[model samples]
Target: MRWAACAAGVGLALVPMTGSAQAQEELEEVQEARRTLLMAMPGTPVSSIWGLVGQLGIGVEHAVGSYVALVGSVQVSGALQGTESLLPGGSGSSGQTWGVGVDPGVHFYLTGRAPEGLWVGPHLELATYHWTVQNEYLMGRPDVPLSEGDLVTVETRSRTVQYGGSVRVGYTAILAPGLTFQVGAGLTALSSRNTNFGTPRVEGGGAATDVEGQQLLGSGFGPNNIRNWSVSPRMTLGVGWAF
Candidate 1:
């Protein structure tokens, strides 16, 4: 009876080993079968990264069939714009900014697959732009030539950051496989919430400008040009890649 009990225990242990070997063999067979299938096909490279994709991508890829693909892309930009006074360039009339910006947005397409060609879609863009204050300076001396007796020297500085959203309708121009160009502009709005006007050191005071009623001191992305509910015309251009 003792020997029979010992044999039963040994058989139970061997059953798990046998099952494990069978499972490993089945796994190997599935892999080699995939390789054999790849070899039988013409001109397609086999990749090790195919297994996870086969299991997951077929369910989520829009190109495969009806699926909701989560698509995302980045917008790289360095835009330039010139402006006129009513800003913060002291008494200067015009200025410019090397506007740097970044925009990111998403779109949902009503299609059963990753559709191609002139497709119009609605998009919302969140963008941030920075304008370096153009230090508008007084050429030589004051226009009135304050005589050297009543000269007032002033030092000032300014900068601006603008953030806003836009609703755009555009066609994605496919230049090639996986590459696209986006160009469109319908409706746009912007508001720069912060605007500052200051003179760091207004030396020799008493030099007063006899001008008033909304005089733009300089042009940049700062105050006066933009405040709450300030509306300006806008344009949009972008490029991206899809993988």
Candidate 2:
């Protein structure tokens, strides 16, 4: 009877120890499964380090599962513009442009893990831009063909709003704990509307002062242009941080 009582005591004592060990193992497993949210910045601020050009943006990534994540970003940028003379001798017609844009995007991670290592994903983006174009003519100039005086002969202006959306496949590599680089290419569909002003306004085939507000590859895309629907190629390269 004493031996049986001692055996019972040993078994009862081990019951609590077995439960404690299982509880510790479960706690460690939970800790290993937990993931941290990551925040990042992409754009000229980050790419400037590599002597590359990039847009400004704030991005975030959250792991929904061990292998999948959700990502999103918001971006704003200024448009580049320049003046070009269309007529003769630098005294003819000239055009100037100004613009600003905003972009927002969402993505789903499909490779490796969220906010770390190598990842490839599909994403969608919406972009909007507001732009202005001004047309000015030189008056009474000897180099110009038909000028009244060396003054403002004619002035016309136009404003445009462009909106676009794109679906892209992107890849990112996290080289270090808080650093990453990305590249993406896609096709975009865009639409634009324009508002014109001034005396000699820009119209098709009959305007003297032509105001053009489109550009591509760092130069003019064409003459006074706003398209209802268009498709174009888009590409991006950037460096960023995940923290």
lDDT string for model 2 (1-243, tens) is 999999999999999999999999986554445344333444322111113334566666666666666766666554434355555433334444433444455445666555444454545545443434443434333455453423233335666666767776667665534466767667777676655544343322122322221111114223565557677776656566544
Which residue runs does candidate 1 get wrong by more than 4 Å?
1-100, 110-115, 118-153, 159-161, 175-179, 197-199, 203-226, 230-234, 240-242
The TM-scores, one per candidate, come to 0.40, 0.52
Task: Estimate the TM-score for candidate 2.
Answer: 0.52
Candidate lDDT (C-alpha), each: 0.36, 0.51
Clashes counted in candidate 1 amount to 4
Superposed Cα RMSD, model 1? 17.4
Model 2, residue 150: displacement in angstroms? 3.7
Task: Name the TM-score of candidate 1.
Answer: 0.40
Q: Best candidate, lDDT-wise?
A: 2
